[model samples]
Structure formats: structure tokens, C-alpha cells
Target chain A: MPGDVNLWPKLTGGEVIDLLASLHGRLDRARKAELLERFDLDPTKRTRTCSKGNRHKVALVAALAGDVELLVLDEPTSGLDPLMELTFQQCITEAASGIANLVVTPPTLEELFVHHYDGAPARAGAASTSGGAR
Target chain B: MTTLTRSRESGPHAAPSSSTALTGTRRLLRFGLRRDRVRIPAWALSIGGLIAYFGAAIPAVYPDAAAMQTRAEIVRDPSGAFMTGPGYGLDDYTPGVMIANEVLGMIAVAVALMSILLVVRHTRAEEEAGRVDLVRAGAVGRRAPLTAALVLLLVANLAIAAVLLAAVLLAALLVNDLALPDSAAIAAGAAVVGLVLGSLAAVTAQLSEHARTASGTAGGLLGLAYVLRGVGDAAQPGGSTLSWMSPIGWAQQTRAFVDLRWWPLLVGVGVAALLLTASFGLVGHRDVGAGLLPARRGRPAASRDCSAPRV
Candidate 1:
């Protein structure tokens, strides 16, 4: 996932989430539901009508709700508000302990460093300490 | 520890050689069809409805042999020849021949437009919007989206053919009393045109960076085809060599209700196959979100407005 992403505008948020997650092999429905709730995204709303933050949440949920081998997120939370940004951090933190390898580019790394590492590691050193990475 | 243990239990993930390049085509095709369910039916019915409407109406307009001959004379005129077919079967013109001559040009144009729009919508539009990147990053294969799009088009065109066949057959049963085989030829001819034009869209999608450009290129070609055929048909009533230059002309040369030639359609099929092959080749060579045609290069330096510091 990148900073600016797009899903089919004609599809509802839930349908977009489901389609992308299934394409990744298997969708974690429970995770999808929980993420949808956490992000306050209206699953029934078509993506074209969604705000930028809401659209980011849709892409975020689709990427994070699948049990894939690797998650590469670049500027993934650019459109998110403070609240949803925290929700995103929480989801990624939980995902770090799972089997998948997580690689997130800065400034997400800067945000995560402040929140996750008790402000110990420098910005350059932070992501490696966070989780599994190749 | 539990997550690490579970990861170990699953062992090393092997390279994805197990899955072929076309692995997710069927799923993508299914989803593509589901996405366009409403759209496909609307295109099919409206185009077929035109055939049905005209099929019933043409008989009323020319009720007897004398009346049919009168209509045929007008059709044989240069303006009518420009608008319609190569003036096929105008001498013996039945209601069936009228539909084939007068109506098939309109039908072919409509079908070609539908096919081009549909193919570009699914293929290049998806890629341009960056939605394709999202899907491609998943378990999907490299070729799947393009394959799925072409396959969906094939299914859609087939459905259009079936609807057209029924529309013509039903009209025949009720009023026109046209022969079954000739009516089938009408439906089949339109479907071949759809496939040929749709395949051209697939090729154009690879040529241009933007969806609008892709569709415009294909549509432009179609217009050129129409003009070429019209001019050729008008110049020589039975059709000159210029008519054969266009795909539309090839389909028209099938001469559905009069002579009902099948070889011209084979030529259409051959050209479509060549276009499809070219499209697939383009897909294999180009980077995702890029076209074979080079995009406009950007300026190296920022503009003065951008270089100025804000207060």
C-alpha cells in the first residue's frame, strides 16, 4: 500500500475491502469487522462519496485484515486523522507480533517510534526494532 | 512466542512456482462480471431492442413486393449507401434483407461502441486509477487482470449475440417471417464485430497511458472504419476494395440476408486474434501503470513560483 491509493469507486467500502482481501488469498473477516469499527468507516458507503480519511481506512483495512506473508506500507496513513492514525498504529503493532513481516516507510516510522519504542530508538533505528523484516 | 511457533510450524514458504501466470483469471473474471452485471445487461438489451424494434417496424413500412422495391430503390441511392451496408440484397429486398442492410450498420456501430467502452473500462481504467496495483500486489497473477477483462468481454459479446438472435427470431415469428439461418447470421455478424472492435480496444489500452486516450483511439479507429466502408460502399454499390480495408466492412460483407457469406467473418476472427495476441504481448513487456507510448516528460527544474520562499 502507498500514500495515495484507489479502489473501485462504484463499490461500497465493504465490497472493496472484501475483494482486495480475498485477492490476497484469504480474508480475515473478524479482523476486517474489528478494523472497520475501529476506523469508524461506514462499510455500506460507496468509496466515491467517502472522505480521503475514510478511503484511506478502506485501503488500510483491506491490507491489514489479510494474513499475508509481507505488508509493505509507504506513507500509509497520510490521509488519516489523529484518531484513525492511532487506530492504524494499534493495528500495525498487533500485526508485528503475527507471522507476517512488516515494512513501513517514514513518517509512519517516526510516529510509531514516538508511540511504540518509549522514544528510545532514533528515527533511523526504529523500524528494525518494531518487528519482523527481511 | 506463540506467533513465532506458529510460523515455524508452517515452515518455509516456497517460491510461487506452483501457481501459473494465469492463476487468478477465473476469479478476476467472476468478479469483473459481477461488477458489470447491471451494465452488461443494459448494453445487451438496448442494442438488441433496436434490432427488435426495427425488425417489427420494417415490415409495416414496406408491406408488399412493390413497396419493398420502392424502399430498395431509395436504399440504393448514394446517401442511403453511405449510411447503411454495401446495398446488399436490395433488389430482392425482404424485411429480413432490410434489417440486414439498413439496421446492421446501426447495430454494428452500437455494438462496437459498447465493446470498446466495456473493455477500456475494465482494463486500462482500472490500471490508470491504481486499483490494479492493489489487486496485483495480492495473490493475483501478472496476466490475470488483462485475461479476465478480455474473457469478460467475450462473455458479454456472446450474451449480446444471444439476445440479438432471440430478438430477431422473435420478430420473425411474429411479423417479418424471415428465415432462421439468415437471422442467426445477423446476430453472429454483430457479435463478430463486437469481438473485433473489443479486441482492438484491448490493443489500444496497451498503447495509451490514459483510459480516455485508449478509448478515444479505439473509437477513432471505429469511425475511420465506418467512413471507409461507407465511402467504399457508396462508390461501388456491391462494395469496392476500400470497403474490405475496414473491419466493419468485413462484417458487412458477410451479406447476411442476401448471399450470407461466412468467409468475411473468418477474416474478422483472424484480425481479432492478431489484436489479442498483440495486447498480451504488450502486457508482458510494459510496466504496470505505464503504456507502450512514452508519457510526456516533466521539466527538470521547478517553476519560479515553486522556488520562491513563503513568508
Candidate 2:
């Protein structure tokens, strides 16, 4: 079950191991291992109901391991720590090298450049009205 | 150790092997079952209970064969027959047959609804939530999840059938006077109808883009089936030929407790299989999160009609 206990019993452990092995290149196994070790999660314990961050980690690891041509990530780093968030961006940038990476997010990340449109008519009206009054 | 280093090291990797898709389907089905455990069982129980309740109530309402005849006469009338079914003028009109005439269509509708909800929840709902993209990026194929969902629906339908059979038998035994074969036949007839509608829903779920649309399509078909069955049964009292067109008609034609034609059940099974195969064929052709007929795209920006100023 590739550490996901919720996977169906019909799928054998060998099949999951094969999938993980294929995705090995995209994700850093050492980092995932480190997180698991730091959290003191049993290697044998399957992930039943994980938190949002944990689910993100699982998804990120899975995504990295495969040849995902287009990673349509929607608010992928919303719930991550600063360090993890930085790591996520780096991973995304790296993954984007040979593929099209489309990441959609709200206007909250400071790292993203914003382009606000100024209303020309409103500005012109204000200037003309002020000048006429003066 | 970092993601940057990993990406730098492993750029432009090969796709996973084909086997990963099968594994993904299994995983998805397991997850679906876990999510819908409570919902599916509740639906099955409610349908089974309704069947059992009707089975027990009918005999008490019309105790003797003469009373059963009077009730059949009312049902045999053009209006009553059109609304319900052809009043099979069995000399000994048993309560089991009476209940079958009254409730089989309703139970079939319930089964159809459950099938629609289950299929759509697994397919379109997952796609809308963006889960399909994640799963698709893996070894999963476009059709595997849909296949798994259909299989799950099949299992659920079979479970409902078994429960209905058990409930009907229990009701007959409790009532004391009703014959056992008659009760079994009635339950079997209803189960056959439920199976057909359930398979129909499975097929419809794959054809429509959204869950609601899929449900509406399946519900419309079910309603049509019932109306056709009622009309055909009413128009030709004892003839079974016209009844074959409608799944509900096929079920009622079983005439459990009266004549007990067990063979008509095979027609229901055949139709269910045909629909299930059609669903599979549709799944094979369509992309994940998409239907044979794609969802129409709306205007990119909000329309003036949507954001209009108040009067």
C-alpha cells in the first residue's frame, strides 16, 4: 500500500513499491525519510487519515517521482511552513524545466509579482475637476 | 536532500509502467468504498425495509382469496392498471403478488438513484475536486477509475438484491398464510428490476459531465421505463410481449405468487449486462474527468446579466 493504508486490499504491496520506484527521480526520498524520522512515524504505519500538510507532502512526493508534463497545481503551497514553501517553489521550478507547470494561486504570496490596472478615466476626471474648481 | 537537488538530478524522467494504472484503480475504489460505506448501506437497508413492510402489510389488508380478488379487480381497471400494472386475474391472488404490483417500481427507482449517486460521486466529483489530475499523473489509465466505480455499483446492487430476497422471505414466514415461493418470486422480480435500473444509471453517469446532469439523465430514463411498463401492462392484461420493452414491465411480468414465471428474470439480467458493457465502452473512449459530450464552456469573464445593478 505504499504507506497509504487506505488503498484497496486488491492492490498488493509490490504494485505500490513499483509505482514509488518509478516516481523516485522527481522526489527527494531522503527528505521524505527525514520528515518521517523527525515526526517519529513508524515506517510500517500506513497513512490512514493525514493532515492537509501531510497530504500535500504525499502528493508532492508522488508528483515529483513521475514524468508529470503539466503540473496544474492550485494553491499548492498554501498550508506549508516557510521552509517547506521555499522547498515547494524550488521543486516546482525544477519540475517546470522540461514541462509546462501551471500554478494558480490567490494574490497573497509576496514572491509573486502583481500587476494592478489604474483607472485612466477616474484619474483624468479628478484632475480636470480639481483644476476647474481652483 | 532538498527538492531542488532532486529535480536537478532527475530531469525528464520516463512515464511509469502500465501496471500502475490498475493499482491506482484498486486504490481509488477502496477510498470510494470507505467514503460511501454509511451511505450505500443505508440506501440498501431502506429499500429492503420498504419491500418487507409492503409484503407483510398486503396479506393483512386482504386476508382471504375472495378479498384478494376484489383488490385485483380494482387494480385491473383501466385507470388503476394504467397507474399501477395489468391486474393479473389469478384466482388465488396472493398478498406476495399484490405487494409486487404495488412497490416494485418504487424500489427500482431507489436502486437507480443510488447507482447514479455512486457513479457520479466517484467519477465527475473526483474530477471536479482535481483529484483525478493527481491520480491520472500516476500509473492510472483514463478508464480504470470508471471501471472500478461500475464494479462497485454492481456489488452494491447485488447486495441490495440479496437483502431484498431475505426480507421478502421473512415477511412471508411472518404472515403465516402466504406461500413461500410466491414471496420469493415477488422479491426476485423486484430485485431484477432494481438491477436493470442500477445498470442504466451506471451507463448514464459516464455519458454526462457533471453529477447532477448524470442523475437527471438516469432519473428521466427510469421514469420513462416505469410509465412505459405501466401503459403496456394496462393495455394488454395477460400478454407479456409488450412488457418486455420496459425493465419495470419485465419485473412485473414475473407474476410472482400468481403464475410465477421465473424465466423473465433472465431478461432483466441480459439488459443489465448490455447496459454495463455500454458503460464500459463509453469509459474507454472518454478522457478522465470528461464525458462523451464535453461540458460547454461559458464566457471567460462575468456577464452583465450576472453582475447587473439593482433597479
Candidate 3:
């Protein structure tokens, strides 16, 4: 799936698959297979006009399936189920460990710092620009 | 995250799959045609029927050649000339020619306005609705949608021309016992004028940001063209040069059914092509949904005109 909704009019599923393949290589193939298995998106069907959540899945899959240098997620967990949220968190952590800078904005500080930091979570009302680990 | 690391290690850029790319233009044209099918035909039929009905009525009011001449004399009277055009041609009037000359300018205006609205609705409207942006992202070039919209308009105009020609000839034959060839030629000439005006409107639509502004601009230009042609037709010698400035004038100069100078129609076709080309060029230089002219920003707060001061 293309990241931008503006790109929807231009892209067919095949074109999207090709683009994903270009960005992520063999992983794109596996990713596509996984998506087809999970989401049941039939290639033969006309490109479906998806809801925001479905669109988000496309973006999430594209992001998680690729070896990107910088992952900047603005509320990435939105519209994801608990299972999918955990899957997304795992993907982010794995990427972060692999030298990719993961900058994710969660709705709550507890969620942002959970299990990642040894210290207390950053205060909710605090204005901190230092990118400090809580 | 793992994927990003892998991609970085592998290479930043990878080869894309060699799938066939769809032409954005073909798809857009199909979509546009579907959208305008009812609207365009309705416009063409309504306008053409109106012209045919009026054309048929013309011969009844001025029943003979002498009556036609008297009507011409009345038209050429200084006061009438001020309202219409120069009266010198009244002596040469036929019912067919009189009808052609009287209504051609206004018909051209109507045709042009129709063309402008159709093109603007297809192009700028799509852009405003975010459809163009979506289509462009897929393998479509910047010019494809614009080109497709123009092509659709051209097809619509041609259909309009055909309908108009048939209606005009049928009315002329039934009402005035006019020669078939002459009636056909006059109808064709009127169609040519309409196409030219429509092309002008199409170009103007591309130049303006909003549909309303584009329509207004095209309408204004058409009005100007009519006035120029009208004054030129009324005046003598070099004054008629103003008519030459307008596409409407080109149609009138055809003198359809009177002398039927067919060559002047070439001018309309040539101008239409030129204007359409200009529109294409303009489309290339601007972003979709934006016009060559910038939209004016208004004040953040309401003004006195917007909000009446209550007691």
C-alpha cells in the first residue's frame, strides 16, 4: 500500500506490490503473502476503496516489511487491535536494535517508555526536548 | 525496524517490477465521458433545438424576398444599426442568410460557454475533489488528466456540431424551402464558431483557480468577442477589423447561405487548436487544482459587509 492517500488514485494493487518489492526486496514477497493470507486481499478483484483502518494496515505493512533507516510513526498504533499493536511494537523494537532510529508517538507516556527504560515514565505534563530515556 | 536495517544493508534503491503501466489518459477519458454523457448531450440538444426553432420562425415573419429586404432595411436604419450591424447587406438578404447573421453571434457565445463549463468541471473539479492527485500518483503523467479532459470536450463539441447541423438543415428545409447544401453549410459554420468559443473557454478555465472564476472569465471574453464583432459588423471600412478579432466574427464572415465563404471557418478551427495547445502548456506548468493565477486570501476575521451591525 502506498503511504499517502493521495497516491491511491494512481496505484493499482500490482503497482503497489511492485513498489513495495522495490523498497524491501524479497521481504516484500513474504509480506504480500502474509497480507493476502491475513487480510484476504484478492489480486484479481478491483482495488478496493478501503476505510482508514484498512489504509493504516497497508501503511503499517509497508513500513514494517522494509529495512528502513528511519521510522517516524505518528500514532502508529491507532486502529490496530491488541494483537496487531504488539506485532507493531515488536517490529519497532527489532528495527531499533538493528540501528534504525524509531521515533514513535504513543498517546500515553507509560506506553512510550514501557519496558524500554529502567527509570520512571516521563511526567505527563512535562516539556522535555532532550529525547531523554525515562 | 528489521526491514529498514535489511534495506540499508542491501541497498537504498532496488529495481521495481517490470509490470505494464496503464495509460492514465485512457482511463480518465472513459471516466470523464461517463460523467458528462447526460449533461453534454442535454446542453447540445437544448441549444440546437432553440436555434432551429427560431430559424424556422424567421421565414414566416419575413415571408418573401421583399419582406426580407424590408426587414433588412429596418435593421440597417441608423437607430437599428446602432443596435444591430450596418444595413448595407439588407439588399442582399435571404431568409436563410438573415437568420444566420442575426443569431450566429449569440449561438457562438452559448456554444463557447458550454465548452468552458464542461472542460472546467472535468479538469479543475477533479483536482479540487482530490481525484487528480490520487490518479497522478499511480503511473500517470502530469498532463494526462488535462489532455483526457480536452479530448472528451472535443468529442462532445463534435457531437454538438453534428446535432446542430442536422437541426438547422431540417428546419431550413421545412420552413424556408432553402437549398440543402446552403442550409448544411450554414449549420456547419455555426458549429465551427461554437467549437472555437468552447476552446477559448477551455483555455481560460485552465488559467483560473476556481471553476466559477474560469466560467466568468470565459463568459466575459465571449461577451467582449460579441461586442467587438457586433460593432465591426455595423461599422464600415476598417471598423469591420474588430469582427476579424473575434471567433464569432469568423462564423459571421462565412456569410452562410448568402455567399457561403467556407474558408473563414478554418480560422475558427485554427484558433481552437491554438487555444487548446495553450491550455495543455498551462496545465504542465501548474500543480493540479491550482491555476496560473493565485487565489486571493481574505482577512481571517469577518468584515462589516459580511456581518451587519445589529441594533
Which predicted model would earn the best TM-score? 1
TM-score of every prediction relative to native: 0.88, 0.71, 0.66
| Candidate 2 local lDDT, B1-311, one digit each (tens) | 00111112343545445454355667657656766788888988898898778766766787777888887787777667777765664455666666667666677667767776777777766665555665665556557777778778777777777787787777666666456676666666665666677667667777767778877887788788877877777776753456668877877777765677778789888998998888778776665656677678789887787789668
**Candidate 3 chain B worst ten-residue window by lDDT:** B1-10
Predicted chain B of candidate 3, TM-score versus the true chain B: 0.84
Interface quality of candidate 1 as DockQ? 0.23
Which regions of candidate 2 deviate over 4 angstroms?
Answer: A1-58, A61-75, A78-84, A87-134, B1-23, B177-184, B239-242, B297-311
lDDT of 3 by residue, A54-118 (tens): 55555565555555455555566666677766766776666666745444556455565563622
- Where is model 1 more than 4 Å wrong at Cα? A108-134, B1-15, B298-311
lDDT of 3 by residue, B1-311 (tens): 11111123433434345423334677668767876778889988987898778767876776777887887777665445444542334667765666666665666667777777887777776666554544453445567777787788788878877887777776676665566666666566666766676677667767777777877887788788878876776675212788788777777776666666678789888988998878777776765667777778889998887788867
DockQ-derived CAPRI band for the predicted complex in model 1: acceptable
Tens-digit per-residue lDDT, B147-249, candidate 1: 9999998999999999999998877665646677788888888888899999999999998889999999999999999999999999888789989998888
By TM-score: ranked, best first: 1, 2, 3
Error of 1 at A14 (Å): 1.5
By TM-score, how accurate is candidate 1?
A: 0.88
Docking class of 2: incorrect
Q: Kindly give the stretch of ten consecutive residues in candidate 2 chain B with the minimal lDDT sum.
A: B1-10
Poorest stretch of ten by lDDT in candidate 3 chain A: A1-10
Rank by DockQ, highest first: 1, 3, 2
